[model samples]
Target: MNPAAPVHAIVLAGGRATRMGGVDKPAVVVGGRRMLDTALDAVNDCARIVVVGPRRSDLDSTVLQTQETPPGAGPVAGVAAGLAVLDAEPGDRVILLASDLPFAEPTMVEALAAAVQDADTVFAVDESGRLQFLLSAWRIGALTDRVRSLGSTVNQPMKALVPETFDTVLFRGVTDCDTPEDVERARGRAAASPVSIAEARRAILEVVPPLPPRSATLGTSLGATLAERLLAAEALPRIAVSAMDGYAVAGNGPWVLRDDIRYAGSSDELELADGEAARIATGAHLPSGATAVVRDEFAVVTNTSDGPQLSRSQDAPVRDDARRRGEDWHEGYRLAVEGTAVTPALVSAAASAEVTTAGVRGPVRAHVAVTGDEIRREGPLRRGQTRDALGPVLPQFLSWCGVRTVADTHLRDTSDSFDELFREVRQPDLIVIVGATGGGAADQLRAALDRAKARIVVGRVQCRPGGSQVTALLPDGRVVLGLPGNPYAAVATLLITVPSIVAALTGRTPAPRQLARIANASEVSGDATRILPAVPQPDGTWRVDPGIRTAHLAGIIDREALALVPAGAADGDLAELVPLPR
Candidate 1:
């Protein structure tokens, strides 16, 4: 790799922010420059700047429209278009970033580029240890084939490409701005700063702390505190019943005759005298004196003047169906241990072993709040209104992890209203508010949260389309998350942020979402993680494309998964897509 090779920076600026009244988000201003410029300035050290979007004019850099091959579908096509323009040098590195991020810093970009020196790809890790796929570095040669595979829609997440041939770069510079209000807040911060870009960079870096390592354990009961070893089972006496009709006999004991026995039902008890025999059905307890009970089917009943005689039938030998006392369970056996998931089979086995109520960890609780005035209700929409779309979607997303909404409230997009709502719903272990955390006139979520004496855990993340995300902790010890109202941004914040908090609270390890790769190749600029909505194909692959219009519910209706285009994706670049959990 050449230490001085010219590096190209690609900024993705083509998101449609419908919540801000269907405005072009990149054109929104923060401080003195547009959000696009803020992102470009942060990565100025790169050799060239390429803007990837629908309109070339939206970006100040050399604009590249999505590729003509896949036509105008969505970000995956746009990325393929961008990567098609890059020079195919072996060591050339491309840094991809999202334009909506107002707080991204140049230092973070440099760090990501440096991390992917020998690997095919590298991405940023946020303060909470979540991977920022949009802000990353890519090795051009490694992703060339994958980029060509994307179709009109992207079904997989961008991170899926990493497992194919990539690595990761963790930094704090990839913040995204998804809603109109987020754009305004970035502008406000810029206006308040002597050097707005520097201030934003500082804000992003302040939240950078490595996440705690995840542990691998077995024998831990499902939901129980994890441990390396298995738990020991208690001593108990148990028996197994014959599943079929057959004779019971001790391996070394004499078999009793059929006629000398008194018939007993399946559950009947009997007392036997020495040298006496009894006929027992399946599940019937063996008499005290009888070593084994032979089946009547195999024993011959001979009628004579004396009492009927009994003996083994000449047809065949009776197979043993008898269970010895304490055969199923020994004095002691370890049936289950710690760190093991409590499966149905395990539960049943424990019951048979006389064990009940295995220790389990408790579930984590989450509270979500959606704030905004323009949000529509689910019922019929009047002349100029619609239903509150986000209200329904956000809860569905959280339900994937089995986390229920313990408390929720909707407030008007006003400071006082927001403050009041926060006061009411902050009782949950964790709280999430959707919309108005940005900078617009109606963006009162951040201010209202401030008034509630909430400590900003992570005020802003460095990523595209979802940068306005704010995480705070109330004085009463409840965690809160503020998500932008743009449907896509809100979904992204929940996907990236909420899951971690839920995992921490519930003591259950978060499982990885299923992953696939975009069939087409695309390129993007800058150093921010980019998330795109996509649909899955019959072949188990995903296609990257645009989402449904904000007003057209049909556009999002068939959305199969979320695709991630890393910061490293170049024009004609291949990225990973993670499917939403079913």
Candidate 2:
């Protein structure tokens, strides 16, 4: 990070002080320091400074002073004039701050610059959702281009000057000194970097995205988190039933047989009267007024002159064998709580409870595509051509990761195809593109990202088999994860990035990883973390399965896990076993 390249601040101090009763607001002192100097101090760490307005002796001498195209034109003109004299290179961050925000903290400026990671602009958003245009950070190149394109509209509102299609980062620390009350209120307010693979996972899980809660049918709710408690639609076992095949008898044993059997689907035909018993199958309703049940194996039915009689054996015990209504769950019973993952078992219970629908978090749709000119389907292997491994495999992996795929496509290595995918998928949670992620001759993911202006959050993973993994965030908050074209590398990176993506959408805290001790020692290289495929042993240890290659994923076929061996780690060391897909 070139501190020189990160931020170049432009202080818009040219606004006519009509709001301040014609006073030179930037020169006005606050907290025993000049407001202009206070603003300068806020961005003191920046490489260059351009204070747009009339120069003041009280202001810091280090800042360059410039006037709007027509002096005193609005803040937009001030921005244009600042850009005219702004000493910044392409990709440098441009911070636009007002000299009158006496309360603006220097740390806020740094934070804004840092947040310009996956966004074109990172500006202050007041609690009321108002855009604090002046107190914002922007890409120097994007801002410059937008300003130059404004032409005659350079003096229009700041909103008009900003690019229409750009991502914004909201900062809560941008209260202005437009009024004395605003100044007083701002003074009362107070304010308070990259990650490892585990650190990345933790950071992602910390994010609770804004996927709305939706009512989904039980069939479609699997793997989604329940957004509300699941109430029993009716109840499990809505009617009382026999828990086992037995004779429903009333009073003591030696009861007369009713001469009829009750099956599971049929209601009891005869309620047992005193000294009478009826045979009932499992799950069949116990006859009303029945007292006890004698197991068929433990009871005797004998033919007598006055109808058959049922009696318990000498040592046979009589017990109630009926399942009462709502025994498993009563009507309106809370079967599953909010935030619970809708598992198959949970769905089974829901079905038993007669629930047709559940309130669940909306499915996070991942639109997947594989990029590579050499990747072909429905063909035998040819020179420089590989099979379409990702199209068949990634969707299944995505399902296990709790992401639903709406489309799976295979495309050539071109920016047009990549950009078209972005244009096509409307508001997807994730866009997973396989292949062309590294800096190889045929790699086109990097160029596509540049063309789309995608902000790279996890630029690359420092892990073996997939060190070129890229996770970028689009302007719309959608994430784009580029996995290496190599099948092994793609699968390796997918195991790491996909779960993090899922956690980000669901806000699920990842369980702490337990290290797997490897028995046989293996030598490794590289400063990046190594993702070694391993087979878990019966004793909770990992047997390193070491033959992984870029062109093939055969090593991962029978492997149970991908172990994280950090840099400088030796043999016999316990490495973290990455959570497997699903």
Candidate 3:
């Protein structure tokens, strides 16, 4: 690689530092200097450089500090985020270095960029010959192409992006600060704890709950939870009803069969004289003088001088097929629980119980905005622009979670764009914001919330693809959840948080997560619980899709459940599964 060839360096600085007891590894002082500064010195000659993490004053004013879509999303994610900030073309040279290498030297990077002249990528091997993927140099085009080929697994280990057949080179002597002995001496006392996924959810729900109960028309009660018990106004089977297509007999055994037929909900009831039978349909009200209903299959008809007569078949017993009054529900009997979901079957039950209206926990009216300046609402994207994926899917998703979406809009990345949305936020109990929650210079949602004096109910969670979500409660009795711009992250956070919010507002508890046996093992990322896309197998086990990434949605379109695998869960563990939007 020629020194004259444009080069960009990406310094991944977002380690959660769990091994070091939750310190900021990049900011840790080693040899009287921050480890990140040591790493940055190695690539000082690069045409441009980007550091992926929170804004740090220790960085050179010229160095770019941007955050991964959801901060603390691991090295691969930081690499991608750093790449996005570079604005480099395919043929440009890039050096990927981690911030934890306290002793990294500039000569190592010079050797890497020089070695990459013969290969598309050159990874530095450690003294022990172990590949240090984070300490590498690559042609920007080649690296991105390989990343695209890796599909949604791009966020996985760097090994995942290896081209099956390609040219590569190896340089040696790049050491990382991972030894327990080295960690013991250099660990700092920073208490920058990453919020756990559970903690974030609990905090957000603690501040947000369901709105008051409201009357809903029976026809429009779908998807709402009942705020009050559905009691029966009239006894089920108000009249003796036929349970099957049969004849209503007036006496025991042999009877006269008449042609007069009685169908369900008929205006009048006919009298069945002694030894006579009346034809009746299933669910039909029995005639006033009828005794028991003998099914059509159980009756044996015979021609007689009086009329067509019937008797119980010798093979079939003479039993009544009648539904007795109040067998299903008596007058004033509880038809449904207070928190019962108003499914189609339940609504039908309400209709049968003569319920014309219901007391239901009303949905929180929501306004959705998918924000980004580089986001193109329509037409093919050009250069850095991307298609908006979160807006179209959210309306349907919120409906499933019992939220009524009142409006939808797209916002550009601007200082006042967030302020405008907040100013117009009315009627809705929630204003859902996508993007603009992280450390990007263009991220204005956070500043806007601060300007409005909104109380942040939840901050960054420790979960991958969803850590950047922020929930805030406004003074105007409304709340909003700021989600990551990436479609996968937005979706992951949406599924986990929305249900809990709905349950809180409606005075009902969310349905417990379904526990399914995990069919495969997944590498635990961090201390937080991970939500992986999964398909529930016919055998009641969940097939986890570990291949999903924060930016891609390829295999996830067909996924039904997201397995909430615990931090140290093993294969065959019964993991809790949350439902995805259908």
Candidate 4:
């Protein structure tokens, strides 16, 4: 804790882990990061980091690794092995850690190190007042003396090294993983926490991998992402040809016209003399000796003693109208790079370049389902029935996000309805379920996901109206996007979320966010990020529509985009814009 003294870390990562079924406990991932990495991160500012464990190839090469004496020996022996490799002084502080604590942070270590004022060592006490002997800070002299006194460090218990009357600092987040249930509890707690929009997107990207690439013809590859760079197979203009219906003259001006007429798609090759001119049509290949093509409007024809002579008009611009070979692109030239979308323009360009097939990921096919017994899609509505406004238009919204909806249907609010729907469908890459994201009586999607053994990536978000959204990945590699039953909230969440899902599934590069200054952001900003419709004013700034209803999309009829106003934003603040599909 001294300002001038150095601090080193000794992490005990070698363990039998009988309670964890002999698995590598330090390598176990919690909260998207490895537990061993958490311990190393807590001591990242230390002078040296020594990990006492079996050598792991995934560890950084700079980190020092050593095995305890006689290998399977206990924590005391691990401490001795770590101290042997450190070149620390007697007064230097040593942070002792067990690599199973996922929530142990550097602040906790600093507090423990600072609390060692009147004692030889300082350790943490958990919420239950149980001392965490391994999560401690010790003076190198004291630790060395204790290890030397113990003599044989093999199979020693932690109690043998614990100094009597050591100082203790209470910590709340130093929970350690000792069993499978503890690991699961940590994972559940991490998943249940609400994340910001950026955090949610980052988490989705970290967990979801792109689908495997496959070769598909350009005709069938529309909406797919290019897996490799698209190169020109051949030149745009295979050979020199006429750009207009003009004369293919052999040399400059006042030339005698030839008798033969050159038409398009004709392969007849004829050489032109120095003073000869031939009538050439558009797209027709030029003769071997032709230098340029003069359009009919730009040429003057006159009868000569032998034949008709062609001359350039004095008022016409002096220009060559012949299309040159390799004008657009030559062979081996890169047309599109990897991760580019296969839009109509790209397809046409590839076709023009004579590229027939390409390696690509998906266009992300999705299956849409609108859940709720009270929602009716057609026919006369009963007293409690509400019309399904989102079911019909969900595909259009998804299309704007680059997802093609394969099928859409209505699901009743029965307990087994979601389970049956998931079991029946298997082709689509995504399943979009509207409603049933909350904990209401009719909301059975979460329970069905549990039965399906899906991995929940984003349980909830820290946003208004759309905070109840959920994104999960099934074991079969399909994604499930759960939206609120409210139509406006569904559209708002879809606009902001589906793009990330598409990128995750198809390996498409995420587009940069569109930012615009909102003139009245303070009026619409709330404790959580507020997503609302907005209209563009005559000026460059946007005007927010703060008081729109979420039950339907009527409020967005005249809106240009949805403004993502940040929490606690002031007037004239910049907000991200999600443009509505026209």
Candidate with better TM-score, 1 vs 3: 3
Leading candidate by lDDT? 4
Q: Rank the candidates by TM-score, best first.
A: 4, 3, 2, 1
Where is model 4 more than 4 Å wrong at Cα? 1-125, 128-166, 173-185, 243-246, 251-254, 259-264, 294-321
Which digits, one per residue and each the tens of the lDDT, describe model 1 over residues 1-582? 565555676777664455677677776655435677778887888876667665554444444444323432345444555677665465787887877777778887888777777666777777677777677777666555556554333434465455455566555434566775565565445533433222333332232221222342223333233222223354333444432344444333243334333333444555555544445566655655555556657656556565544556776565555676566556456664543444456656666665555444333356776776666666666776646777766666776644566665666766587666666664456667777878998888667666886556556665666678776656775666778777767776677666555554444444554556555425333476566667766766566663334332344456766666666555444454545655
Model 3 C-alpha lDDT per residue in residues 172-244, reported as the tens digit of each score: 5345665545643332211022456655555555556567788998668676778999998999888789999
Please report the TM-score between candidate 1 and the true structure: 0.50
Output the lDDT of residue 137, model 4. 89
Scored by Cα lDDT, where does model 2 land?
0.74
Model 4 Cα displacement at 502 (Å)? 1.1
- Please give the CA lDDT of all the candidate structures: 0.58, 0.74, 0.78, 0.89
How do the residues 1-582 of candidate 4 rate in per-residue lDDT, one tens digit apiece? 465677889999997898999999998876656789889999888889999999988888889999998777889999999999886899888899999998888998888777764567988999899999889989899999999998899999988998776888999866889999898788667678787887788767767779899999978877789999999999988888899999999887789998889999998988998989999999999998999999989999999788899999989998999989998889988999999999999999998899989999998999999999899988999999999988999999999988899999899999999889888999999999999999998899999999998888888998987999999888898899999999999999999999999888888889999999999999989898999898888888999987988999999988889999999999889999999998
Cα error, candidate 4, residue 391 (Å): 0.3
Evaluated at residue 559, the lDDT of candidate 2 is: 69
Indicate the residue-level lDDT of 433 in model 2.
85
Query: What would you estimate as the lDDT of candidate 1?
Result: 0.58
lDDT of 2 by residue, 1-582 (tens): 344466789998877777767777776544334567778888999888999888666555777889887877888889878888876677889889988887677888888888776677776777788877878888887888877787774458888866665545555555568776554343223100123576445434433254677888977767677888888888668877788888888888789898778788884366667888888898777777787667777888899999898888778765677777887878999987777777798898888888878777756788888887888877698899877866887888888777888888888866588778877787678889887776777787777776777655555555676766777666777888888877777877887778767766654444467787775435663476778777777876677755467677666777677888777766677888875653
